[model samples]
Target: MNSQFWDEKFSLNPNLYGEGPNEFLKEQLSIFAKGKILFPGEGEGRNALYAASLGWDVTALDQSYIAQKHTLLKAEDSGLKLHYLVCDVSHFIPEPESFDLIALIYFHLPLSIRDNVHQTFEKSIRKGGTILIEGFGKKQLKYSSGGPKNEEMLYDIHEIKSSFPNIQWEYEFDGIIHLNEGKGHSGDGHVVRLRGKIK
Candidate 1:
């Protein structure tokens, strides 16, 4: 989706993806000491806000201005500060090795540029920095839950592993899991979960 596509979506729904961080992201981040973190496609700022509360210097990027506004408002209400940028993922270029961690939660992209985008993400994190991701698996098409219906946009364990060849995986999973991440995502779903560190 482009900026206008997401802007309209966020503008229409007050909490498109809920106000809480993804369950997987929350669980994984709890074990790490606070550090600079990046959240791409962070719609509505749920994860970014949560990270800021945990003392991480959080930077969130999204294509939607409406989403950015909602995130900033939530951050202010919670007395937490976050760095948010309104830009398309294709145009966003983070400083090399600038982040201790990067989170990609349900951030699906077109197959055409998926590899390039992941490459950018790989370069954005410092050596040995961690990456945590949870996204719809290709089998999600069989379910009526969230995520893109297009199979090409969905992920698989092998595809994810190949996309980040420089990462040494700690855990990689692909299976059905129940989700209750607010109204935006609720129900049993097929997903791929990956936790890895840069080599």
Candidate 2:
């Protein structure tokens, strides 16, 4: 995947996922005190912008330059600011304990680099901080609702748990759920959700 693919898609529609943040992410953030948070693979910055508006120090990363542009424009429109970076998740290396939270909403990656991405992100969160993830489950391929068509890129509970071995699970779910985030993610789909603290 290259920036051009995303640039054209985003250029066609700014609200690919929607203008609002993920509903699951919004609900999960209520329990945490605002602090430094990172959103990896953050496309269009909906979640990051929402966190910024809520007074959280937000940093967003994505591979698409056009995506960053759209997100920053939205941030400006909302009177909010966030540190947005255009970088590939596979190559990103965050400083140790740099984030109070790492939110991965639909942050799917290729299997070749998924493990490394998880390992890199694991060291970025401070002790007692949270890693919240919500993405389509393996069964989502049955639906046309937004998600990778490739089964390998979809979420698997066991593989995900193994990725962040130090996580002390606080909440987890894997089953069918109705989604209405935008035209991209609408209707019933199988999804996995996890909220946990790193030991």
Candidate 3:
């Protein structure tokens, strides 16, 4: 979808996607420690804003300026400070050994960009840093819940393990969850949630 699609959707009398972070993200927050966190493809900044409220320095990156505007508005409404940028993930390059936590929740990517993104994640994470990722699993195709229809965009445990060989997996699994976040994603969704530590 293009920016116009999202802009028009968000311009509705009511909000298109309501407020709040992804439910799986809320569940994973218990593991977060104080540190700089990177949220790639952070549309609307719900997750980034929530992390900032918990004292984490957050940088939310997305391609949509409109989405970034909404994210900033949401952050202001919550009295939380957040950094946002309208940049394509493909061109994003974070400093090496910089982030203590890097999150990739529902940030699906085309195969051409996935390798570079994974490499960036691996290189940017500080030693002992953690990466928390939650996204549609391959099995998600069976459900109608919001996610890319492209199976290539959906991840599986084996694929993740193979992609980030240096990262030690703390946990990786697939299951159904009640997603009550907002309109963009709401309903029982099949997802893969992974937690890994930089080794």
Candidate 4:
């Protein structure tokens, strides 16, 4: 979906996704020390605000201005601050080796630009920096929980591995998992989870 698509979706509710971080992100990031982090497609600043609360300097990017506004509001409510940009992934240019970690939680993209966007994200992290991702697997179409219906937007193990070739994977898995993020995502779902470090 494009920026307008997302903006309309976000505007439909006060908090489209929720005010809490993704479960996988919360679990995985707990293992690492706090540092500079990036969150792409952070719809409601849930993960970004959680990271900031944990003392990480967080930066988030989303094409939806509504998402950006909600994120900033959440940050303010928690007495924390985060850097948020209103721009699509195709236009977002990250500084090389600027972040210690990056998170992509259910951040799906079209097949036309998915690989290029992943490559850009890979280059934004410093060597040894980690990337954590959790997204709908190709099998998610069988469920009505959430995620894009188009298979091209869903992820698989091979697609993810090829997307970040420069990363040494710590763990990668494709399987069924339950999701309970907010009113938007709730139910058993098929997903691909990956965690790796820049080579």
Candidate 5:
């Protein structure tokens, strides 16, 4: 989907996906202290603002002005400040050894662009930086929950291992999650969750 599609989708409802962070992300963060974080494709800024509340310096990047609008608005409402940027992920290069944490929650891209973006992510992360990602797994089709319908976009643990071979997998798995958010995603869904540290 392009910016127009996303812009229209976000414009249709101001709080389309509700105002909260992902459950799994919250649970995972419980074990570690927050730090400088980069959130790629951070739609509506839920995760970024949440991280900011936890004392993480968050930089959220996305191509949609609609997304940045909601993100900045929500940040202001929550009394949290987040650095929001409008940029395409495929070419948004970051300085190496920059961030202590990187998040890619529910962000998926076409195969042709994914590799380069992933490469940038791999190179930009500090040696000890952690990456947290959550996305629909192939089994999500059975649940019919919100996500891209394309099976190719869905990822598995083995695929992730192969894709980021240099990252040490601290945790990676697939399981069902109950999502009660107001729009787009609501119900039990199968998803892949991963945590890795630069090696």
Candidate 6:
């Protein structure tokens, strides 16, 4: 991923992908108890801020320095503190069994490092901790909603499951859904969602 591209994109929009948390993530967090959580490719920090507001210790990462700045500004506005990092998810492998949850919401990555990133994140969560993911499905190419234009960067259920081989899934979905996430994402979208715990 090019940091310059992302920096420019994030710098241009105040609420690039909206200020509200992803609905799937919001619903999942609602049922969980507060604890330490991580958000890789957290973008402008909507999900991270939400978790922090719920009293969870939140750490978020995005490759763009501009993204980090935007997230910090928002966090300041909400009076919430979050540990934000500016780095690619591939370079980040959190301490094993350290996090209560790891959120992978709309965070698309290159095919080269996708599997490794997924497996590492899967192993980083505590026993019985969850990994929640939501991303554009292969069929998203037919939609105008937010996601990578590169098909290889999109999600495929079988591939996703293979990437996190040890997870005992609690729930999964791969189909179309309505999205209204600011100017960056809108209209109908094809998506894949997963909630799983280590086996």
Which residue runs of candidate 2 sit more than 4 Å off their true CA positions?
Answer: none
For candidate 5, give the lDDT of residue 167.
88
TM-score of each candidate? 0.98, 0.97, 0.91, 0.97, 0.95, 0.98
For model 4, which pairs clash? none
lDDT of each: 0.91, 0.91, 0.81, 0.90, 0.83, 0.91
> Of the candidates numbered 4 and 5, which has the greater TM-score value?
4
Candidate 5 residue lDDT tens string, 11-120: 99766666788887888777777778898988888778888898888899988899899889878887998899998787798999898888888888877787678878
Ranking 1 against 3 by lDDT, winner: 1
Score residue 193 of candidate 4 by CA lDDT: 92
lDDT (10s digit) by residue, model 6, range 64-149: 99989989998998899999999867788788999999999998888888888888998898999999999999999999988899
RMSD of each: 0.8, 0.9, 1.9, 0.9, 1.3, 0.8
Model 4 stretches astray by more than 4 angstroms: none
Cα lDDT of model 3 by residue, 1-199, tens digit: 5556655665662334456776667787776768899999887777888889889899888887777888888788879997898776778888999999889888888887787789888899999998888998888888776788889989887887678877999888788887766776778888888899998
Off by over 4 Å in 1: none
* Reference-based lDDT, residue 189, model 6: 97
Ranking 3 against 5 by lDDT, winner:
5
Task: List model 1 lDDT by residue over 1-199, tens digit each.
Answer: 7889888988888786788888899999999989999999999999999999999999999988999999999899999999999887987888999999999999999999899999999998898799999999999998877999789999988988899878999998899999887677888999999999999
Query: On TM-score, who's better, 1 or 3?
Result: 1
Tens-place lDDT per residue, model 4, 1-199, is 7788888898887676777888889899899999999999998888898899999999999899989988898777779989999986898988899999999999999999999999999999998999999999999999978999999999988978899989999998899877887777888899999999999
- The Cα error of candidate 4 at residue 193, in Å, is 0.4
Candidate 2's displacement at residue 111, Å, is 0.9
| TM match of model 2 to true structure | 0.97
